[model samples]
Target: MRPRLSLPKPHRRGFLTAAAGLLGVSALGGCERFAASPTGRRALKAGEDANMFVQRLLLTPASLAKEFPDSQISPWFKPNGTIDPPDRAYKALAARSFEGFKLRVDGLVERPQDLSLADLRALPARTQTTRHDCVEGWSAIGKWTGVPLAEVLQRAGLKPNARYIVFHCADTMEYAAADENEEAETDKTANPDMEARPEGAENQASDSQAAGSEAPGAEAEEAQGTPIRYYESIDLTDAYHPQTILAYDLNGKALPVSNGAPLRLRVERQLGYKQTKYVMRVEVTEALKGIGEGGGGYWEDRGYEWYAGI
Candidate 1:
């Protein structure tokens, strides 16, 4: 078990109170208006940046979240966010027990690879019992087993400029028109190394469509009606942390669909929202511009802090 990295309970309470007071100053309508203004946006960005900087100082790259023994595992780990993705591709894979599923690793890398559940399992693996702290003020402890993210990143060979890692997942969430346009722009960035889709991409995509799933780029057709696929990003530091893993199992059994089946990110140091689920692709990038509203994550775009360090 790693040492616990946290503030004292009183300090945490004081911080929360100060934060709420700041937020309370702006009434509902005024808050929206202010957040939309240029100055307000800049101020918000500064606050977020400051918070990230301070948190990173405490949550160093090699610092691990406190882990517990098997005896401390929670009886019930409550599921949050999208438990079961409604996408046809996800449903099809789930139906067959993810036999044909493949996790694509691409973008700004020397070698792009597609790995299956078996492939991931065959790699060096880590299992730890860690507590999941949610943004909603809930926590659950569970044992997870998977390959360390660093192992996969090394296998893919990150490019010299690679600065961030993005997790593209199967789950989808709807956004307003403005948000949709922002997402459209994000898909425009080119990955030179991935210009030619990997072989596994074609195979998996075709299989998905054949099984009633929508083809890639179907989101455009849906327009106002379609839901954007979920995604999240983290820096190399977190990516290589010993405890950060691409979890495939929970407790002692296979991860359930309700808890991000086949694969999910277990970034133990951060809050639950950063723990993306149903992950399908790993994209290494040089910058986050035009990616998910330029905020680096699904929830981050909607005002959540990018670094949700405890």
Candidate 2:
């Protein structure tokens, strides 16, 4: 187990300053050198360890980052990751304005939930404007509103073993279709006018038809089927943070489809990807290794760190 260290609230600034100084020195030296040298790695790790210790010590359960007034809202908040869902179900929901969509909350809770958009909207809500810092090095500010995640967890009666909360999404990485045996055999007998469609042309055709149809874009759209929206998991410490919420509204209005309509997770202290959009499920588990690549999140499995505390 990691040791929990505490420092006075007033000293946090100084602690960070000192840690930054150490980091500067460590970075200037080779990271390998720091790792190879027992003393160096210990010192470098000390900065992170100390920060975590201080946060655990000085920050009370009620402590929260400042919430700014609406007048301070950012002018533009770019959508990241999958902007538009390609699944027929998602498109159908989108066509119906998401009225038929429902969010499911299950796993390690006393009561499983199948909540409608209206049900989530009916819950007590919180709204705030916060900056989203992506690992890619861009930032955006947006207003978000949703029920507190703790409230939801409490309502569900979180199991004692639960240590992390996972968000499941409706998007996925696209894959290429494997070559068909029929196509391979037909290559020998195909007429000059009946050449096989190029992958690009096939994709373009699929994009033009509606999902579940023979129309040009239909197959493409349907094939894109509603991917399980991107999923991510965070430790229970952050899950229970006061700022963590299931956001239902953005900018004082119902969330647009482009911004994950109905509901989303807002874990303020982590990187932007940790704030999963188009959330369909929330699962509480003691360990993340059971999910995805056991790294905690989709991006985490793809090289991002799981603990992205700001």
Candidate 3:
């Protein structure tokens, strides 16, 4: 068995809370000031890269994150990000208790697989109670049970060229749709014979359009005025870590919708955002380019550090 690490007590946890708050403020202010300038952004990115390098240098690749006992599990584990995805297709799956839900594992694999929750549950599983440290200065301990990511990766058979793992999720973020509208206008200009559709496409139901179309690695295509879906990525090293899992149960029960019900990532060593919720597709790729802004994660593209090590 792998050696287990232990976390500090409540007093030291308080110290971490204060330190996280200061770091959060500093990071936010720096981004607000420097993100717009090309040189400034590069400098910020350099700092992030350096942080990643130093952490990797100091810690062994397989070093486990600290774990706790059942008694130490927080009474209430707080949820962040999208608790309920606004996508209609996701709602349909959830309504039936995710019977039709299949987690798609594709991209740079010898054998791409579409795995049901039952398929995952049948695999050898790991259970651990660990503290989730959020960048927003809160922490909660919860027991998570799921298959180790390495097991799934091994089953998929990674291509030798694969360098990173990208996680596509169900939740989305709202942003101005001006760019989408502009692209539509440009397409119309090029194809003068194209028939024009009304604004908002008749507010059509997404599930109706996607009925019987549960292809492996398929995500809901963005519609005009629709939100951009959430995505995140990690390196192959972390992906294969013994402690990293695709958690389906939380605190001795099936994970609730409010807590990433169908499946969520438990990358114990990183901050909360890196533990992406509502995970749908796992894409293995050689590079981050063509992924969200080519920054490896939704928040990473928005100037947050991609490594986000705790």
* Worst 10 contiguous positions by lDDT, candidate 2: 183-192
| Alpha-carbon lDDT, every model | 0.75, 0.65, 0.74
lDDT of 3 by residue, 1-310 (tens): 2213232223444444445544554667556565567756655565565556556767887899999989999877776566455566777787688998999999999889999999999999999999999887889899999999988988998887888889998875543365644532221111112232333322334322322232222243343344467799998878888899999999988886657769999999899889988899999898999987888897788778898987
Provide the clash count, candidate 3.
0
Ranking by lDDT: 1, 3, 2
TM-score for candidate 3, please give it: 0.76
TM-score of candidate 1 against the unseen true structure: 0.75
lDDT of 2 by residue, 1-310 (tens): 2212232354666677657757776567576665557765555555645655566576665577567677878665655565455545666776677777888889888889888878877887888788888776877678888998877777777776777789987654343234333221211111112222222321232221412332125565444332223579876677777799999888877775555655778988777778887788888887887677677787666545566766
- Model 2 vs. true fold: TM: 0.70
Runs in model 2 with CA error above 4 Å? 1-54, 175-229
The 10-residue segment with the lowest total lDDT in model 3: 185-194
lDDT of 2 at 105: 81
* Model 1 lDDT tens row, 1-310: 1222332223554455445544643534577788777856765665565465557656656888999998989777766676556565777788798999999999998889999999999999999999999887778899999999999988998877788899999876653455534543323211101132222232242323422334344565355454477899998878888999999999988887667888999999889889988999999998988887888998888787888877
- Alpha carbon lDDT at 21, candidate 1: 43
Output the number of the TM-score-best candidate.
Answer: 3
